[model samples]
Target: MTSTDRPLQALLAAHPADLPVPAVREALLQCVQPLTEREQVPLAQALGRVLAEDVVSPVDVPPHDNAAMDGYAFAGASLRPGEALRLRVVPHTVLAGGPAAARLGAGECVRIMTGAVMPEGADTVVPHERVQIEGSTLHLPADTVAPGSHRRCRGEDLRAGHSALPTGLTIGPAALGLLASLGLDRVPVVRRMRVACLSTGNELLEPGAPARPGAIYDSNRHTLRALLTRLGAEVIDLGVVPDEPAAIEAAFRRAAREADAILTSGGVGAGDADHTRQLMQRLGQVAFCHLAMRPGRPFAAGVLPAGDTAAARAPTCLFGLPGNPVAAMVSFLMIVRPALQRLMGATPQVPLPVPAHCTAALKKRPGRTEYLRALVQRQADGRLTATPAEHQGSGVLRSMLEANALIVLAHDQGPVAAGDSVDVLLFDGLL
Candidate 1:
């Protein structure tokens, strides 16, 4: 539902906030405050980090005009079309990365190498293969090359006193390499956000341990850890917590004390066993939202400061996901991922959706959003086709494993028919 509707608008005007999926997402992103703290790190350690400020180039790339290839350097003005010209080859070879100590006079050429400084009075280069070299003499074809060819001008790559890298960009391998080209040994970037992850449920058990008759291994914690690491957050894994309120409270306290953000899988439902929402009210301020979305409708996020006083340490952001396997993962991707990216001082990143046609009919309901796991395939005619899996259960993890993409259905969308174009969000290559 839109935020301006009568019921939602009145509730927003009266009490604490309860929002739709889109409104909740906007609120969560706004909670990601700007980071002013900066630190210098070596180039090797700066990968996946956000720049704190703009980096300016200290010197021009290829400080002087240099030769682009190993050839004879001479003025093209001396060449005669369709005729062979003779010139004296300088005794000294101008090797790459070396100073050019020779000057070219009329009817004279200097043997030049790639990346070497261009000699004075030389504006062209003829490849050695095109020239016949003789003892203390060289024969260059008249029309073999053009003027100003094979010349690498200074600052062609990066002009001196210019912005090399802008702020708020995440440093990747290519970015680090560019900084190295500028002779930068270290770079300034915002510090990484510390995240605390936890999975809550009495029926959950960690892997590699014996599972009771009713207990199942907790995979949500592992999923959150990997995702947090991929987002460049320093994860403080809190493991699994039981259904008790005290234990949940303890976990939240510890997480708030140490981490900048807290992510929990499960226990946002309005059941007796789920005490996450209750404890959040007592210790922190959180908004529990039942969004109009399938598989991941239940969501919660807010701030939990360290102490009871108003001015405690910086508050820890909390993201409470649903309990089901596929639901938890979907909720994390749709909501928590973007929020964490903003929290880590990165720019707002929106995932691009590709259009695809449906190969088979699928049942859909209006007034609710749906995320169907599907395998996106390109047809022979270059049209993308999305075929939904046989089962679309929230608890089924096999569906998630088999599908490489998600078909996004809007809240007002109805049943989808064959050949209908749909928006698909890819799961691979983006992360």
Candidate 2:
């Protein structure tokens, strides 16, 4: 039977191991999509790009043994309590990145600065405040330190040929610093994936336009575009298409040719005007449709075969989300985001669900899972409490704006009383 022909529970029971969140994640990972090849990018432009290969240190991080402090480098064995030792300060003194100077001997010392390479035969460093400099001669206090006390040994931070960053690491500020420390001017990173976004509805108009009678402004297109762009995808806006199969088919064909993934908001339900599902089935293989979750129930995913025969058969993925603004966004976050991450050759995706106590009663059906819009606040006792928004309808987009989390009510769960513990799916940057 088709996905829509069976109940959600029956569908899940058919593939028990692949319907849960973790199982769905693993199934997507098992697909044979290749990661885009690496390109050499300047260090300044590599932030947020995934590393294509492991980065090994070409040379020692410090490169040479140096002083960790500004002090006098001398033989510690020659020092005696209450006794003073004096020696001439070596000319052309060593500084950081400078050549090492003459070796220090018994009863002799060399004036050294922080990060300066320790001279041969000098094993201990006495702080500058502990010594009295008279012209070129340096006077050291009676007490001396043990050997190698203040020397920074080479390869302390990173040794040559050591792996500094593994493959699949998302490059960030700290990773860039490590690359700089390894003396790399360029880094190899995966090429950014291109995503196309569109909104489908006859009654939808662009924001700021004079609303025609019975028409609403489209907000899902902008929201999905922003979310996709933030994930490093090159987003292309296809604008809006009416509820016509021909128009949707054309858009789908164009998206298949030009984009790695196509995200369309609306037109995947049971209504006659919902043509996205029909067009998707005609163009690609529909993997699944209709999940067991509320606010995002009418979802669909598929893959369109590329036209080229000689080139490897690459499939462009598609996500048909619900028509309601909140449902479209929720479906995108829960399903489409992970699929995009997989296409980009990143590590496996995992959804983070934080626990919170419900401050008010939550009423819901027993079969379908519900994601209630909630404003999470930290209580005086340091515990997080979720207060449900006033408007819980799927079509009410205003309520979603004020919500920071989706307080999840599991399948088969009945009405929850006040103070009930629940799992909350926090939106990005909300927590």
Candidate 3:
């Protein structure tokens, strides 16, 4: 082993096996750190990338004091209590994007359009519908309009020289608009994370191939790719590999060289043909091969050497998921997602569980945590109720299809009775 691989060796030695969900999450997160690679990209291409540094606004968002809507601009000091106010209309109309209007004379008001710059010496606005206009005179009833109403002050949206977007924030649609409003052409964002994914098992075949006895189509890679893509990762799709140790080792070496992290589905169980667990033991430092969780119990994580002496790249993180389809997806959502976020220089966010009433009875053991496929519905009274899917088997991918959320049963919790409250992880914002 190289000198760079020593830290992971120590980490693996210190970690225990068959950890609980929270312990496993904490341990894996503690092992990996964020990458420092960043680049300047055009605002159009920066969507979904993490900000490397805080973006300070060079100018105020609105840039100038402007009208929030079509209105008449005048000094608020002219109004008298419980008395009608009358003012002569200025001849010029202040249009948005047009030149600024000349200063208003006493008892004079200017017609303004939405987003139009407020004329000089104006501090209030009265909308057209709220006032009466007679020829060149503008009339307003007492107490009908308030001072500074309908005027959008400069820097009200965002002040100049303030942090427009903080570091580590993901650039979404709203962020894009904010950057555009600040007149920023380019932004510095952390580089896209590289993740390599593949499937193993001799019984697996591609989708287009002819049906064969005892063979199943490989769906894990496609599912993994979609998950990685949604998280703004650059996925390296290493297609299906047989259960041979030589082929598996070659795939691992290639992934370690090209990607920052590696994800493998299948061959993590203790079967004789489970070469993934064996290869992970041989090629990487194994943190843990099992977790006290249902559906995805056979999970593995550690650091793999890049094995490229010339480039001397840092070790790659590995996540060995189960062969079952539902288990693989659940494992990705519950554990692997946040770790990958940390590696991308973004803050790790774990989905919080909300209390929901369970509509059906659930039988669960006391030693392990269980995540049940559930359909969560908001009741008429605004409370949420969760119903477990008919099929809860790990291989039942349809269970995941019918579920919009997962009912999280704690490790020490026992069988749940009908109408009992349970913690649920909603998939609305998570997926």
lDDT tens digits by residue: candidate 1, 213-240? 9999998889878888988889999988
Top-down lDDT ranking: 3, 1, 2
- Model 3 steric clash pairs: none
How far in Å is the alpha carbon of 10 misplaced in model 1? 9.6
For residues 1-431, write the lDDT of model 2, one tens digit per residue: 11232233344567643244334434444442646666989999998788888999999978887888988787666666677677667654668778887776556677788999888877778788777888888876565455567888889989999999988787879999999999999999888887889988788899888979999888889989988877778898999888888898888778878778888877776664677777787787765555667787766666776556413536776777887878887777766677677677666454568889999987777766778999898999999999999998888989888998889887678899899888988876421
| Whole-model lDDT, model 3 | 0.86
Of the candidates shown, which would achieve the greatest lDDT relative to the real structure?
3
Model 3 spans with C-alpha error above 4 angstroms:
1-17
Query: Per-model C-alpha lDDT, please?
Result: 0.81, 0.76, 0.86
> Which pairs in model 2 have colliding backbones?
none
Please report, as a residue range, the 10-residue window in candidate 1 with the lowest summed lDDT: 1-10
Tell me each candidate's TM-score. 0.86, 0.79, 0.93
Q: What is the alpha-carbon lDDT for the whole of candidate 1?
A: 0.81
Ranking, TM-score, top scorer first: 3, 1, 2
Ranking 1 against 2 by lDDT, winner: 1
